[model samples]
Target: MLELTNVSSGYGETQVLYDLSVTAKAGRVLAVLGRNGAGKSTTLKTVMGLLPTRSGAISFDGATLPGKPYEVAKAGIGYVPETRDIFPSLTVRENLDLAAKRFEGSDWTIERVVELFPRLGERMSNGGTQLSGGEQQMLAIARALLMNPRLLILDEPTEGLAPVIVQQIHDKLMELKRGGLSMVLVEQNFGFATSLADDVAIVSKGQIVWTGSPAEIRADIEAQHRWLGV
Candidate 1:
């Protein structure tokens, strides 16, 4: 559903990605795992068009993703950046409403997202700033769901949260996976990423260094340590 071939991109003068290639199939999760400064987040940003691609190609659902963030989004990709990017002053309901898209034939509605995260229902009127970290994360994902995107891209969904909250987030993600949502997840938490991913790719210095199934990755401790420092 998503493919990047020899993609090279950077913030400005310093090039971060070099001939990076990766793929995420339809109705499956593809986790890009790496440690801090491994350029995992940069990969997502380039794919989402937040950073320009200097070389190579990126195609989603059989068409090229325009090199503009809004155009990429309008082309049916939902991105939840590591920053969470929630409007602090907007109410939970307001946030969802702001992201709701019908032009792409959305299958998700406010009711559906609220049902997926019941806590969101109770806090519909609460401002985004009022939510805890976990709650804020839920709100971010929930807003994306309302867009009914063809492919979901999430960066560090579980970062900086308590273990319990991480589990909660993981549970919801698994639920989404079961529902056949295509996702590209960039995460530093190897175990969490592998658990929900159908395929795994280890990224190092903005390039994919290893590609395998979760089981293969688990059995290769040396590869894990070398590429991921796990």
Candidate 2:
């Protein structure tokens, strides 16, 4: 459903991606893994057009994603950055309403989002700043779901949350995976990545150093450590 070919990009003068190539199939999850500073987040940002690419191409659902963030979002891609981009003052309902504004097809709705994360329903009118960390995360996911994205790009969805909340988030990911939602997940947590990823790509120094199934990755622990410092 998505493909990146030798994508090289950077923030201004310093390049962060070096000829990185990766692919994500529909109804599957591609777990992007690496140690910090391995350019994993940069890969997602570039793909989402949050950062400009100096070379190569990014295509989603058979068309190119131009180097523009709004255009990319409008082209049926939803991005939940590592920061989880939630508005502190916006109510839960307000947040979902904002994301739903640009949606134009049959994929997601506020009701579906609330169902996916029932907690959001209970706090529909609560401001983002009033939510717990886990609730905030759910709000972020709900906001993205309301966008009706064909492909969801999540950067560290489970970062810094409690273990139960992490498990909850994982369950949501697995649910989405079963529903055939194509996803690209960047995670530093190996256990979390292996549990949900259909494919794994170990990135290193701005390039994909290994691409294989999770089982294949386990069989080559030495390489995993070398590339991902696992």
Report the C-alpha displacement of residue 229, candidate 2, in angstroms. Answer: 2.1
Worst 10-residue stretch by lDDT in candidate 1? 97-106
lDDT of 1 by residue, 1-230 (tens): 89999999998899999999999999999999987888899999998888999999999888888999888878888999899999999999888888774433478888889899999999999998899999999999988887778899999999899999999999999999999899999988888998999999988898899999999999999998898888
Q: Candidates' lDDT values, in order?
A: 0.90, 0.89
How do the residues 1-230 of candidate 2 rate in per-residue lDDT, one tens digit apiece?
Answer: 88999999989999999999999998899999999999999999998888898999999888887779988887888889899889998998888888887674647888888889999999998998999989988988888877788888899988999999999999998999899899999998899998899999988899988889999988897987798776
TM-score of model 2 vs. true structure: 0.97
Off by over 4 Å in 1: 101-105
Q: With candidate 2 superimposed using the best TM-score fit, by how many Å does residue 101's alpha carbon deviate from the native? A: 2.4
lDDT for position 211 in model 2: 88
Candidate 2 colliding pairs? none
